[model samples]
Target chain A: MPGVKKCLQEAMAIPGAIGASIVDYTTGFPVAMTGAAPNEDHEAAAAGTADVVQAAQSRSLFVSAVPHDLLEDLIITTAGGYHLLRLVPTDFDSRLVLYVWLDRLRGNLAVARRRMQTLAEQLVV
Target chain B: MTPAKSPGPGSLLTRVAGERRTGALVVGGTPGGTVYLAEGQVTYAESAAAPGVGELLTASGRLAARTWQAALDAGSAQASVGRLLLDQGHLTQGELELCVLGATYDAAYFALAAGTAAFHEGVRHWLGDVVSIDAAALNRESGRRIRLLNEIIANPRIDTAAVIPVPRPPRERVTLTAAQWELLVHADGQRTPADLAQLLGRAGFATIQELRRLAALGLIEQPKARATDNPDFVRLPRMRGASAPAHRHAAPESPAAGVSIDLSIDVPLDGDPTRAAVPAAVATSAPPVSTSGDPPAERPRLDRRKPGAKLPKEIAAEPPQPHPGTDEVLLKRIRTALRALR
Candidate 1:
């Protein structure tokens, strides 16, 4: 099992990555974060993203036809970067989302999403 | 060796971490909380004042209680309950950590608050250590939380007492966030913020924060010291007989009193308005015969004005004659008494 730090390191290594964090969506705390500048407010980002994830999950209640699994990853594209969040399913609680902010010019959304899923699969804690 | 007397929570934790002691720091003894430390690091903390990780998990709708119990049964022999839950996909590692983090801090707040505590060596929690936090760091965080709470809420003790909701009049509506609404719906007069949190399956701290916010907004009230809290409560009732005539003669041209009379006159002089205004005016205008100051004696009278309480025909119809001081008092008492009667 890859530890949180190791997982974050690998996530940060993704092409065009600006920052990455394993966030606990339930409490909005980042378990680990890397590749962000000193001034970057990763905690605020984690909390804001957790709210987005919660809002998305709440939508599952109204939209009965689509299963929750279909929305495995939530992607938000900004002018300068791409923000990708993938849910990490676990045995106990699945309220975890791996968040990675990528430079739009250097990152490929398709590639980052696939890599994050693989990395999240190996996360132990 | 006898332990030092009256050591602060931080020093006690620092000493424990220095020795790298493993076991529980039991605070407040019987039905007290335990802060589980592993080699001087905090592995877990629990308090009777706060809910545990299991409660939080189930309350959050993340795990069923029975499933958790079954996992406990299965993992009991190996001391790997966390692992069992993990293996069964109850929650992700990050989620577990978050729960642990929140629960630890929640419990620690109460544990450290107890101040006087004892260390029990070699004790272990069945769930095992999901993650470890430095005791010193935990202490600092707890302190920071206390300070933050003080900043947000004037009286932190609202966490302990039952929060009676003071419903506003239909015209004077208050807006609430979803979380605040949930809290309000669950806030029966009997439940303290802590009790409400337990019932709602939310973080106790968050619930307390909401209570404080509500208190600041005059939405929720602590039952303690209710009578004297309002300056008007003390002054208004006495303004009756003596002060009434004296004020009427002295300030005949008073716009404030004139506005109040106008407001009362506009009350259609019908049904309950005439009756309501006289007694209310009398009740409020009557001079205080004695200042004995027993709250219980005043409680029933004050209770009538509570938000949810049925407003007497006159008081409801005529709105108290506009003595700003008396009006302010009337408004406050009404809100204070508006408990969710159930």
Candidate 2:
């Protein structure tokens, strides 16, 4: 199993990836992060991503009404970029999600979604 | 010029860091905690006010209580419990490191209040060292958190009080953040912020901060000190000095004396999870069974001690029973839900 740093590195390698973070949504803190420039407010963005995940999990409309309802992933598309969040499955009571920011011009949303799922499953932290 | 030379939480930590010492610093006094150092870096810390890592791991459903107990039993003497857990595949190396780091920071926050810390040479926690946190960095972060908490929460003491939900939310239509909603669901007027943190499997500081936010928004009632009403207080006099005047006067004041006595007994018993779990048959037999069916002999024995000294009849006869509280049951359900997520 890859550690958090390795997971972040792999995430950064994804096509058109601008930034990646393993965010603990419960506390709105990043477990590990990569790819953001030195001046970028990655922590603030990670905190915002946490809110997005929380909103999906808590709101009735966003929550899946199936018998075993759990959020799978979240995606946000803006004019310039795509934000992808995939929950990490863990035996521990951790509310962690892998978030990747992709440039709209270079990234394929479909490919990013599929790639994130694999990373989420394989990521060890 | 160097300021008052006192061996406090910060000074001791600074001293250890300067010396690059390896051992345990037992910080004692009110709100005391222990910080374990490995070559001047903090590897583990524990506070009486904060839940330990074992509790955090167990309560979070990441590891079962039995699993933790087994690790302690097996690896405590050797100081390789963390290694054992990692070797067993219970948690990955990264997960263990993160868990230890999170718990150390959480404990250090509450433990670093102004107080003298004593150093114990060569002592170490069983988990050994997965990662070393710089003492200076930890102090700064803890200070930052305190400042953040103070800014959000007007009253710092509210963190220790029992949090209760507003009986009627001020707004007819309200929107709650995920943390606020969870805090509301478990508010229950009984749990403090610290308890809520454990219940929710979140960091202690995070829970308190969320609670402060909730309070600021008036989404939840400000936490209040628990009521002074003590059921045990009444039981004290009744158990000792059977002819106590206060009891005689109190009994006459109540119209339904016999029924009230039973109801009062029920109230305290029901509130106590331990006593409530005892079967009726076993409970009824408990008082008599303690003295071998001789209350007279027990009375003399009890009288030898100070007044109100006899152990409550229920306590003396408290039987072993499965006493899972509501939160434990909820945590189990949460674990099941988490399993489904996996």
Candidate 3:
């Protein structure tokens, strides 16, 4: 959907956003992305992110008292930046996960979270 | 023997066309490669130079040895293994096609590289395919010079003769498709990619593709041949349960006893007494009967009630039919006759 592109662009436009991608959770495929990589290997990145998401999901299932479906978002802050994975379920078992790489220095965790929620709600998958 | 100069596109095509063989031909260079297979041709392809098709399939969790063997037998008898698996509903058409393409490409890539080292026409090796590929298309897609094949052969990584095991990354994770998971579960580490494909009822190409993908992900490493052993040989990990001997024995025994005594024997009897009764009656009635000599009793008839059959019968026996327009019909007939005569 054009909305996905708009959402990704909007996410990227955020002050500290380094890169953003819309990933399909089921197949671990990238539906859309906005970023620059040296190798330009978006497929590999999407696949890698998908794997990370799966691991996180499995971990949540094992450790948490809450049911698996309650898992909404995962945030990993690295020395370079913050990696946010937001799972958005749609009409079918098909799910959309918005992956945002935010520069730690400029990124406001609160604002990014709010913005991601708004964007995820507005996203028409 | 040193690999000869990489064949020109024209020469590769001519060779393929002249041979009129059906199977994928892979051309590798700096970037990547391509594969092409004829309708009925078979190819031998391996990934990581260590694990062959069987190992790849089993490692991927795709198929069990017994199940894979059954499919292989069926495939051999059927028209094409790829097509047969699809028809048997073991794999989807898309999966089959992908498997075929992937296996062919992987095999061709290794085979061409190996072929360059020591050229032999008739002697069949188990690692790569015998089919030819469209060399021009491969070079064009990969965007590499054809001459690079000769140089690539010199690198021991690509050479079958060296048999260096590709190093596997520790704690690396991979997201596998359902079929890939099945292959890995069944791998038990012994079967090669080709063997796994046959057992899993998957095409060779698909198994190889998964192996390559897994290798790229660094989950599995290729095996290296030792100085004491044959240089060209590659070894895969031992089967899944090989290391845990006690667990292997204990695991199967518990499951076997529990399942056999608890579920297998009791479940059907407890759940469907009728099913057990029917079989028992059949067995008791024919003690010394030859299973092949006599046809089995006819399968229990299904309740064959046609969709609207009951409705029609109900409607038919309801009551006397109504003659709504008898008087009107008689009046209309009189009027029509009068009009016609006039």
TM-scores of all predicted structures: 0.60, 0.63, 0.31
Candidate 2 reference-contact recovery? 0.34
Over 4 Å off in model 1, which ranges?
Answer: A1-10, A22-31, A34-37, A40-105, A108-125, B1-5, B29-32, B74-78, B88-92, B169-171, B222-342
Q: What are the per-residue Cα lDDT tens digits for candidate 2 across A5-96? A: 77778888889899998776755666567888224976677668878887788778977657656788988898988889999876544567
Alpha-carbon local distance difference test for all models: 0.63, 0.66, 0.44
lDDT score of residue B313 within candidate 2: 49
How do the candidates score on chain B by TM-score?
A: 0.64, 0.63, 0.35
Most TM-score-accurate candidate = 2
What lDDT does candidate 2 reach at residue B36?
88
Candidates ranked by DockQ = 2, 1, 3
Best model per lDDT: 2
lDDT of 1 by residue, B207-301 (tens): 77667777777787533322122211122222112112222223234445444443333233223433545654444433343533655433222
Candidate 3 Cα outliers beyond 4 Å, as residue runs? A1-125, B5-36, B39-55, B77-79, B114-135, B139-231, B234-342
The sequence of per-residue lDDT tens digits that candidate 1 reaches over residues A1-125 is: 55566788889999999999877675455655787832487767876887888777656453346445345888999898899999876543235788999999999999999999898777633
Residue-level lDDT tens digits of model 3 in B30-51: 2122234343233333333223
Q: Residue A73: error of model 2 in Å?
A: 3.8
Interface CA RMSD, all predictions? 5.7, 3.3, 13.0
Error of 1 at B167 (Å): 2.7
Kindly provide the TM-score of model 3 when superposed on the true structure, using C-alpha atoms.
Answer: 0.31
Best by DockQ: 2
